[model samples]
Each structure stands twice: as structure tokens, then as C-alpha cells.
Target: MRWALVGLVTFVLFFPVLAAFFILLPFDRDRKHIHPLISFWAKAVLTVCPLIKVRLEGAEHLKQNGTYVLVANHQSIGDIIAILHLSHSFKFVAKEDLFWIPCLGWALWLAGYIPLVRGDRMSGKRAVDQASGYLKRGVSVLLFPEGTRSPSGEIQAFKVGAFKLAAEVGVPIVPIVIHGTRDFLPKGSRLLARRVQVTVKVGIPQQLAAKNNGSVESFSDQIREEMIQSLKSIRSQFKTGELVSV
Candidate 1:
């Protein structure tokens, strides 16, 4: 299968790079430069996968060192790699499984990513506690409110964890819509032997801007509604096969 080949190649080429990256953790004087390197590595591997073409829009909307939370729609396995390529120095919460994922886990930890057990609320609590540190350092934390990939490739209702973190840390929320990965290499698929184009739209950044903690929950609810609107605006076009760059 094409996926089998792709997986083989991923491990063959990536393992060494990952090992080197992991080994550099304690000695690496600079963490900022490392994320781009990892992102670039992923971008380069994905290019050779022969199944996807990635594009980004509204990059200018991002502000450097902006402390915030990012929530995006989940589509496919490739979604992870694509976002890493597009996001620079952004630390997002991920499942604890990633920590045991050989070299990738080590690098992720060194980069300040928070990990949760996912199934356990206690893990969420720990992750939230850790996220507060990231916010204080002015790092961007990505969240997929749906908590899991959508089986139907359509939008799923989002959870409140990201908003809770935002409220706890008092940071802005950046809503993003990622289009097209589900078709290329969706859930339970293998080998991207053909090329498919994917687009990432960076929407208007929604600020929490709440006057009090009591309003945090409501404010984040509004922010979620805005993100849903932003994603829906683009969803129709993608579904209709009229997707264009931007």
C-alpha cells in the first residue's frame, strides 16, 4: 500500500533527525529556532508523500509573541503535520501518547508543548495547570474543541477546555479553519499516493476581553460561535469543490 511505503519512509528519514533534535534538548540554547526546523522537516517529508499540497492564508494576521489560544477544526492525520509546518513556535496541547512516540515526544517536550491523557479529566486538569505557564511565557496554545477528529469530515461541536484555559490565563483566542486534509488522508487511510491541495485560513483573532472572570465562560462561548461562523463560511466552498487559495 502507498501508506505503508509512506510510513516506512517517514520512519527511515525522520528517526535520525528526531534523535538529533531530542539530544539537543538540554544543551540547545535556543528553543525558538528549533520549532521551525521541526516544522520544516515535516513540510519536506509531506511534500514527498505525493498526496498533498499545502497552502496558508492570512499569515499576516499572526502577531509575534502574542499570548493566545488557537482553536482549529480537525480533519485527518495529515492535519497534524500541516499545522506544524504552518505554525512557528506555537505550543499546543496534545495527547500524552506523543511523549512516548520516540524522538518526536522529546522534541515536543523541549518545545514547551503540554500533554494530556485525554480520556481522564485529571489529565485535563494537569494540562491546564501546565498551560498557564505557557500563557505566562506568551506562547500560543492550539486547541481543537471537538477533542477528537470528526468522523464525517464535518464540523463537530467543540468542548470548553481551551476556553477554560483562556479564561484562567486571560489570553486572546485565535480561531482558524483548516480545509481539505480529510479527503487526502483521512481517518483510517493509508498512503497519499496522489496529490491533493489543502488550504488553511487564518481568521480574525477573537479577544477574550472579558471584564471579569465571571464573564469568561460567556465570552469564550461567543468566541466559539465566531469561530464556527468563520469555518462555516469556508466549508461550503470546500464541499462544493470550489476551493481557492487564500
Candidate 2:
């Protein structure tokens, strides 16, 4: 029943919003104007599905007018929805297949989000170039450095692309850890869980310098370790009810 309501909302809002996006494109060349609309759409979807609750913390770490290379651990499709609740404006580095998903894909393209073809060197290079351009233009770009969803909901080995992009563009790397989305909508399942609490913890932005001596791989590992510790902390806080949902 919840899923039906969510779908109904999406179906009703998707077309009109998409049309508005197209009509506004000529005036919104930088695509900055589209993000807030997308964020609103995401919020509306979440609002209709009362079963999935989202809590966000460390939002203070994000500064207005700050460009970031935002990295987050991937758990499920729900992670995207949960992250959209953030007030920060950013472009997502999403998989190419997601760009083929009807209205959702079209919206992504029109919004100037980067699409990556996994395992394709040329595609990855293109995505990096595009994301770097956005950062250079003072827009944040979000990527799941794990490259794909972690089936077991554990922090997987980090991929170096996100860190490399940050290093290239000289932007701060902000680590965001999301928990409980794996249970909300696990991989390989179309059905949403009946009730789930999703928490997103945004960590302080770490500026990349010569600390790793130009070794993006090592830097990526360092960031991943910090996120691993963050995940542990979020779980502990959730259990003890230490976090205040915002």
C-alpha cells in the first residue's frame, strides 16, 4: 500500500516537473536552478511514504557557496533518496543505466549530472572530466566511491576516482555515511521494507594536499577508513538514541 502511494505520487509529479525542466533549460544553462526542484521532488516522494524515516546529522559541515567532491558509501537505491534530503546543491555521478530509466534518467541528464559506464575506461575518463568541470565551476559533485551498492551493507574497498577528482580540482572531500537503507530497499528487490529508519551522517570536509604524496589510492584508503569509523559511530548512536533526526 505504501509503495502504491509512493508510485502514484511519482507518476503524478514526474511528467509536469520534467516538462518544467525542459522549458527552463535554456535559462538554466549552469543547471543550478534544477537541483532545488529535484530536491523538492525527492522530498515530496519521501513525504508520501511515511514508513521510511530519514535523519540527517553533521549538516553544519557543509558550507553554503562551498564546492565539494562528496563521497558516500552505497548500500541501496534508497541511499539516493535519503541523500537528496540534504540542502546542499550537487551533481551526482550515477551509473549509465540509471540514465536510461525514463523520466528519472531524462531528469538526470537535463540537470547536468554525470553518467558513468562502469568498467569502461573511456566513459570513466569522460565522467571525471565532466565532474572536474563542475567542481571548477564551484558546483559540488557526489559519487559513490564504492562504484556500486555493497550487498552486505559493509564498507567496501574504496575506488580512487572520487579522491582523484578532488585532488585534480582542489576541492574538499566530504564523506557522507548512510545507514539502514540496505534494509529499506535491498539490492535485487523491487519491494520496499514496511518500516525503516535511514540515517545520513555527513563528516567534515577533508582537503586533499600532498599528504599522500600524490597517491590518490592511499588517500582514498584513508578517507574510506574514516567512513568506516563513521558507520560504526552512527550504528552505535542509533542503538543508544544519541542522534537527533533533522
Candidate 3:
């Protein structure tokens, strides 16, 4: 019931902002104009959810003016709010199904978020192409290479599309490690819980060189490795029960 209310109030309160963003769609081709409003909505949601506290680290590594393909592990629906807290303006490479949602979906479309139809080869290629265009235009796009939320909160193997898009655009890749969202709202459930400390680590951007053979498989593996180490470091904190002071 708590999460339900959060969702309801979030939509109700933010509906006007969403409509305004939609009206500005013509001028928000790069999504730069609407990002701050989106950030405000996301931050508002987190503020209303008293149980979740976010601690961000390594954000200094994110350059204020640099463009990147930001990749992160997806643990639960809450990851979206957590990532938005970073306040970095990036369009999310989201699932096509999400675009069908009423107001929220319309807002995403107006803001230029790219959507991908899972398991469709053609849709994947189109998504990569769309993301490439956004990158070339000096906009960063966020991709969850895991493709879906982790049922076990374990970082899964990455898909190659994000790396491929990065290589195609010749931009650096930024790996973001997220921890504890699963405990806040587990997979397949909307129940909200409190006192959950969500930690986010933004690693230094990495420039990936596409191998001569042109396959980004190795590049994807390298990023997955780096994120795995980050998650491991965060898990150790859980054992100690001493949350970092942010």
C-alpha cells in the first residue's frame, strides 16, 4: 500500500510537469531541457520514500561536460530513482513495453528516451542506432547491459549492444555500480520497505577499443568484471553493518 501510494502521488503531482515537458518536446530533441524536471520528480519520489537512503560515491569521476554510455546493474524498479539521484542528464535505453505506460510513457517519448523490444533482433539494431545518434549529438545514454532486473541482485553477464553502441559512437563507457535496491523493493513485488541504504558507485570512465575483428564481446566482459569487483566491495560493507558516511 505504501508503494502504491507513492506511485499514485508521484504521478498525480508530477502530471503537470510531465505535460509541460511534453509540450516542449519540439525543443527537447537531446532531452537536455526536460532532464532537470525529470530529476526533480525522481528526487521527489526518493524523498517521499523515507525508508530508502542513497549514498553516492565516485561521482567526481563523472565529468560535468563529458558524454558517455553509462552502464549499470539493474536490481529492481527502484534502481531508476536511485540513478536519477545522480542528477546527470542521460536518456535511458528502456524496454519498449515501458513506453506504453500512459503519462510516464508519453514523458519518456517526449524526452527522447530510446526503447528496445526485447528478443527482437531488428529492434535491438534500431535501438543501437538511435543511441548512437544521441551520443554523437553530445548526449549520454544509460544502458543496463544485464537487460533486466536481477532476481538475485547479482550482476549478470552483459549484453554487447551497449558496448557496440559506445564503440560506434567512439565515446567512453562509464560503469555505475548499484547496491541494496533489491532489499527496498524486491523483484516481482511492489511492496515498499524502509531503512534500506542504497549505495551507488560511479567508476571512472573507460575508453574501449573495438578489437580488429570488430566484436565487442571482450569489451563487454571487461566492464562486467569491473562492476563485479565494485559490487563485491559494497557487499563487504553489508557484512560490517557500517554504512559509509556518504
**What are the TM-scores, per candidate, against the unseen true structure?**
0.80, 0.91, 0.87
Task: Give one digit per residue, the lDDT tens place, for model 1 in 94-209.
Answer: 87876777546765765667788878988888888777776777767787787888888777877877877886777777777777788777767775534677777776676666
lDDT of each: 0.71, 0.86, 0.83
Ranked candidates, highest lDDT first? 2, 3, 1
lDDT tens digits by residue: candidate 2, 29-82:
668778877777778888888768888899899997899999999999888878
- Give the TM-score comparing model 2 with the true structure, all chains together: 0.91
Give the best candidate by TM-score.
Answer: 2
Model 1: what TM-score? 0.80
What lDDT score goes with residue 169 in model 1? 79
Model 3, 126-233: lDDT tens per residue?
988888888999889999999999998999988887888888788999999999999899988968754688998999998775452455888889889989999999
Note the clash tally of each candidate. 2, 0, 0
lDDT (C-alpha) at residue 51 in model 1? 69
RMSD to the hidden true structure, all candidates: 3.7, 2.2, 2.9
Error (Å) of candidate 3 at residue 119 is: 0.8
Query: Lowest lDDT 10-mer window, candidate 2?
Result: 237-246
